[model samples]
Target: MDCRRSRTNDPDQWIATCPEGSKAVCEELRDLIFRWEPDLKESVNSNMLCFSQKKRVCGISGFKNHAQLTFYRGSELPDPARLFNHGQENASIHSIDLPDGLEGLNLRALRSLLHAAVKVDTEPTQPKPPAAPREEWPMPEVLAAALKKNKAAAAFYEQLKPTYQREYKVWVGMAKQPDTIARRLEETVRALAAGKKWAQRKEG
Candidate 1:
């Protein structure tokens, strides 16, 4: 599938145009879910068709050879049919894959899994883990020297977020030739002094 043209709001279009052979089967499964619960809303996210009511219940992703039905809160769902075969180590998600050449799916088992997953989604939620702190990237010698030479640039560089600083660091570090490195360091200082992020400068 040409992901660039994918409609983020339409799951049917995603399934219809996916290059995967198992896409037909995926469509069948999706229809079954909609039939089971008519109120469930569908949308495409991160190259997958996500279904949700109050919270995310499940998502379907189509690959070249197979398709996957991923449960957002899958780890908590019981599987008497033992349908969940992937993503077991993840704390919050569980997935079932339909590999190429699989003849047919057990509809009854799949329905049971879907209903169980929805039940989990509707249950009371727990407090989520705190977000991780961002790591600061070490300043490269070339960038540091350039910044040191220009007080305005130094202040600007210091004020940038760690992620933005890393972009400059990585750009300067990737230049192999001495002249290339020197030129990039010069440009970096000029860009910082102008309050522009790396790669944001207009080309002449």
Candidate 2:
């Protein structure tokens, strides 16, 4: 099914577009969410059925062979049941894959997860403290000498902001091998002469 065929606000219409293997599981998960948190506002965003209150609490996405239930602030929720099977490395988002059509599903554990998610959404969140400024990387001697020889590169490098200058410094300074440092230094000078930022440099 072409999930991106159209935007849908109706739950039934959205579920109808899910892959055949995952449709039933997705529907059941949707019902479970609504039953547990009747106050959550439902909407389809980016082809995913999302539930939100003060903020987006959770969402349901259907894939080829499985349905996924995602918690927006899942990193903050307790999952003693170990039901979450995906996105462990993510900072905030986490999800559970419901394969095999919900067979052997743990309803009690799932309910606990849902309840915790809703509670997190309802609670007021504290503003995050400002991040500490990153220490600048020292300029590599090879790059400094190269810049000194090329007037155009030196002029361009000098005009760049500290953030952009740090990019070239970190890239060249990170190379431990002498050959690697020489190669990166060559690339750095060429990029700077062409007025390209470190990220904008073309790979050979």
Top candidate (TM-score): 2
Candidate 2: list runs displaced more than 4 Å.
1-6, 126-204
Which tens-of-lDDT digit does each residue in 77-184 have in candidate 2?
A: 899989889887776789888877678878899899999998988787645446789987998888899999999999999999999999999999999998999899
lDDT, model 1: 0.79
Candidate 1, 1-204: lDDT as tens digits:
213434555776888876567777678768888998777889888777889988989988777788788888887877877787888877788888878423566678888888887777778764556678766656688888888889998898889987888899988888889999999888888888988888784443
TM-score, every prediction: 0.56, 0.62
Return the top candidate by lDDT. 2
Evaluated at residue 132, the lDDT of candidate 2 is 81
Minimum summed lDDT over a 10-residue window in model 2 is located at 1-10
| Local distance difference test, each candidate | 0.79, 0.86
